[model samples]
Target chain A: MSDSCCDGNARKAQAGDCCAPDGNVMLLSCSGGSNVGQLANQACVELTQEGFGKIFCLAGIGGKLSGFVRSAKDVPRMVVLDGCEVGCAKAIFKEAGTLLRGYVVLTDLGISKNKDFARKREDIDQVKAAAKQASQAQV
Target chain B: MQIKILGPGCPKCHKTEEVVREAVAEAGVQAEVTKVTNTMEIAAAGVFGTPAVIIDGDVKVVGKVPSKEQVKSWLGK
Candidate 1:
């Protein structure tokens, strides 16, 4: 149960209702050691703030926590964002034996991977769009 | 042979159990069928999807309710 008033029942509840976290979609980001990774993390943060979905911990799943792994498996919809083709996020899910759904690779979105910590707003927006699109297509 | 249905007791999970039982009876296979409703157990079994069917330690289906015919085929009917 959420404390927010918007429960998808009110006519005022728009698509990106920020009243509460959307349980329907879960966001997982790589947050690795790269600019693209930072972008992925930033995009997820912004999306969660915008109520697109609730950001979940990939580390918990990577650590093989029973509760975290179970939650990841049980979530109705999930968006996984990876910084690069190395697919750190995807590997974590695979190692946990969890099914991957609504996956997006930042590099695949025409964003180049680099050591630069400074991420561009345009790249972040692109990642966010790609994440939303992937989630919609999958669930 | 051992058969396990993994889920959190959702409607689909129950439906899967019913179909699996029907297939077992129709196929006349000497298999023990059980439901695993524990989330931890399901994860330990390496199944991330609900309404999953595991036969003889092999995962046969995941995330969807399979038909009776599909279960029978797994039972070699």
Candidate 2:
């Protein structure tokens, strides 16, 4: 049987080959120029550093770079984190015709969007928890 | 010209390959279409996304499948 055979890899159609090297979940953040946006960005970076996921460039994807777009489409798992309700990160993927396996919104977690709100550890922690929860959801 | 499509044999990748073929035929351009499905090669080619087009070893298009006109234009036809 082929390595991509459908034995135990049921999510293959939605995700890529289960045996592929894309085990690292791709994480994207809006990272807008705001307080909550900054928190989302920091949380994604921490998640990457912690080996929970790999922070990918939303710009590259938005720019419609073929490789980045293709990778996003075929990645085993992808998590999109947005600050506030703008959902820019999610919009980028949607515009690029990519599917996100996980999604998080900071504002929904009681974090208000403001230009002056400083990124505190507590808020960051909350964002991290939301992201983790998103990644664990059955897509 | 050597036209390479970087993808992982996904549906979109296959679609890109087909589009390239159609574009070449429509433009009547003398070009070779290559599909690079190996993840490592795609990454080495600086493609973090799929369904990208590389022309003469230089990345030209990425992410979404290109339109026929866009493909022809990239081929300089």
The lDDT leader among the candidates is 1
CAPRI-wise, candidate 2 is incorrect
Model 2 is docked with a DockQ of: 0.15
Best by DockQ: 2
Q: Point out the worst 10-residue segment of candidate 2 chain A by lDDT.
A: A1-10
lDDT by residue (tens digit), candidate 2, A1-139: 1223112334563554332324566778898999988898899899888878778888878988755776677666777888978789888888988886688888988888899959899999888888888777734
In TM-score terms, candidate 1 sits at 0.59
Off by over 4 Å in 2: A1-20, B1-46, B49-77
- Candidate 1's DockQ: 0.05
Which segments of model 1 are wrong by more than 4 Å? Answer: A1-33, A41-82, A85-103, A108-110, A116-125
Ten contiguous residues with the weakest lDDT in model 1 chain A:
A1-10
TM-score of 2: 0.61
Model 1 Cα lDDT, one tens digit per residue, A1-139: 1212222233323333322223447788999999999899999899888888767789888988654676677667889999999999999999999999999999988898889788898989989999989998965
Q: Report how far residue A134 has shifted in candidate 1, in Å.
A: 2.7
